[model samples]
Target: MKLAVVGGGSTYTPELIDGFARLRDELPLSEIALVDPDERRLGLLAGMATRMLARAGHPARVTTATRAEEGVEGAGAVLLQLRVGGQAARDVDETLPLECGCVGQETTGAGGLAKALRTVPLVLDIAETVRRLAPDAWIVDFTNPVGIVTKALLDAGHRAIGLCNVAIGFQRRFAAALGVAPERVSLGHVGLNHLTWERAVYLDGEDVLPGVLADHAEEIAADLSMPGWLLRRLGSVPSYYLRYFYLHDAVVEEQRTKPSRAAEVAAMESALLEMYGDPSVDTKPELLEKRGGAFYSEAAVALVASLVGDRGDVQVVNARNGGTLPFLDDDAVIEVPARVDARGATPLPVDPVEPLYRGLIAHVSAYESLALDAAIQGGEERVRDALLAHPLIGQAGPADELARRLVDANRSFLPWAVSR
Candidate 1:
């Protein structure tokens, strides 16, 4: 079977290619294709892939294409990991929300809405190309605003799977926190990407959270190095996006206090910009090599390995509600644990989420509906509703005024907007 990776020049490509090599025997990958718009970046990725395969002593043909159609042709599976706009645009996404008195984080709120607006059209174009070129291929999407982009592809009438490593990655972390092997822990997860909760976890057929959290309080506090520390302190497992959650309340509470040194925050922005800057710079190779060893890459490799190895029933956060969340549309992109097999993914049933989570789902659903409406009909009211219904907007609004300001501010990115 052939595998095609779109966004081939991505920083994550080498790790993904390395991952495929680990599973090449099981999947028997006859060919691999790398597609990217930037030839320089594509050349770098193509060269890296060649070296990786050489090191592994495997001789699979690796091809590069600047055209999306050519890259996806004859592929059995297409892995998408593109960023529609580059880091400069993402900087706008991150800062816009703060300007509007809301948390200016990417992947949720107004920032996510902006991202969805810019990304959906491009992603839809790619999906259409895949439909024409490889009608039977399963599109595995790893793009941000994943829920919205995935829904756009499905709404446009294509077969695709939204994949997020967050759900399973967190499950394993929480299981280890509770002193149980990941395979031995049974878990239930549900919500939107980066905003999910562990409803339950059982080890050796017994509930373990109460005892685990009570005993591990200090250790958990110490380990809040990644996102979701506050939630963990409040007796819930942290999602991959714990940092946003931590900052939400912090941003609100610190409104009176002079903003302290945001060194960590500044450092992160600098690092991301440097990472996404010129690929021809001398230090680029070392940077990419170091990134190849991150936890995100490791998680991606583990997921691909699980699918190819047919390693029993591993759970993943995939799209398709299919009763995992009856409160949301059956066809909506809800994140829940899914069973993977050689046939494909089957979403495991999760009980209805708690009222708070369900309420959050309602908020997300509004934005998703607006995104789809805009994509289909090019309407402004739907987009306005999306902005007003966002959690951050609610926290920072005279809804009508905030919506108007955001719509006006982001007119350039919107599908339909009144004259500025």
Candidate 2:
């Protein structure tokens, strides 16, 4: 099977290669086409992957391409991990909104909306190319704003599934806490993309979340950037991204005092690239762990295996709602546990969510719907609608200002912004 990674030059690619090496038997990889526009990083990654695969004694061939259309020609599956403007663009996405006293982070608030606008159109274009060349290929999107990007692909009639490592991260964390293998910890993970909660953790078919929370509350709470008492009160684990939503003002203030995550990642990428340039370096470096997106390799490998191999196993992922949550539209793309197979992802039944969670899910679903509109059609009014609908920028004054700043800062990437 041919698997193509669109942003195969990303520093995260080595971590993915490590997973493919360790779990080489899960997926039959005849060829891996690393596709990226950046020639230097692409060549370095191709050699790095060759070294890693050789170390693993895997027979799969490693190939590199400078064009998406060329690399994805005969792929059975394609993974989207592209960053539209690289860390420089992310620097804007992470710092721009802070000027307006709003949460300034990628994948949320005006910043995430900006990323959606820049990314969705480009991914759609690539999807079009895949359809033309590899019509049966399954698209596994690990792009930021996974929910929105996946929705765009599905809306365009492409077969796709959105994957996030948050669920896998939590599962691994919980399993370590329980002294069990990662696969033994099953999460009742629910919500959209980064906006998710672990309501339960099953160990040997029994819910042990309460016990985990009781014994390891402070450790888990610190990871989520919330108080342990709050975790005790809520009886669930909220993903760290929720901190931006739950404590918007506090987060903004904290963000103002520090360098943007993009800047930090930029420095990290520079060093990581230097390491990848070393032909003697075969394994993923220790520094890559600090680069974040932990457990991505395992998550990506397992999801691709399920899709290409038609394993029909259950995994937490982003897919169509399909009435799983009564409040959301059937076409709404949601992050939840699903039974994944060759056909597509079908959301598993969720326990009735509280109105508190449901209301926010519904609210964000509305924002995403509008966001996708602005992303696809592209207009000033459409951008305003999306910003206003967003819970982080619901008021007119802040929404309008952020929308203008977003477009202005991203004009290079947003064709509509340039044209207008």
Residue 282 of candidate 1: its Cα lDDT? 23
Clashes of 1: 2
Clashing pairs in 1: 227-242, 228-242
Per-residue alpha-carbon lDDT of model 1 for 293-361, expressed as tens digits? Answer: 234444454445455556656566456776667777777787776777545567876765678668777
Each prediction's total of clashing residue pairs, residues at least 3 apart in sequence or on different chains, is: 2, 0
Q: Which stretches of candidate 2 lie over 4 Å from their true place?
A: none
**Cα deviation in Å at residue 197, candidate 1?**
0.9
lDDT of each: 0.67, 0.92
Instruction: Return the lDDT, model 1, position 407.
Output: 64
TM-score of 1: 0.81
| Residue 19 Cα positional deviation in candidate 2, in Å, after optimal superposition | 1.2
> Best by lDDT, which number?
2
Scored by lDDT, model 1 comes in at 0.67
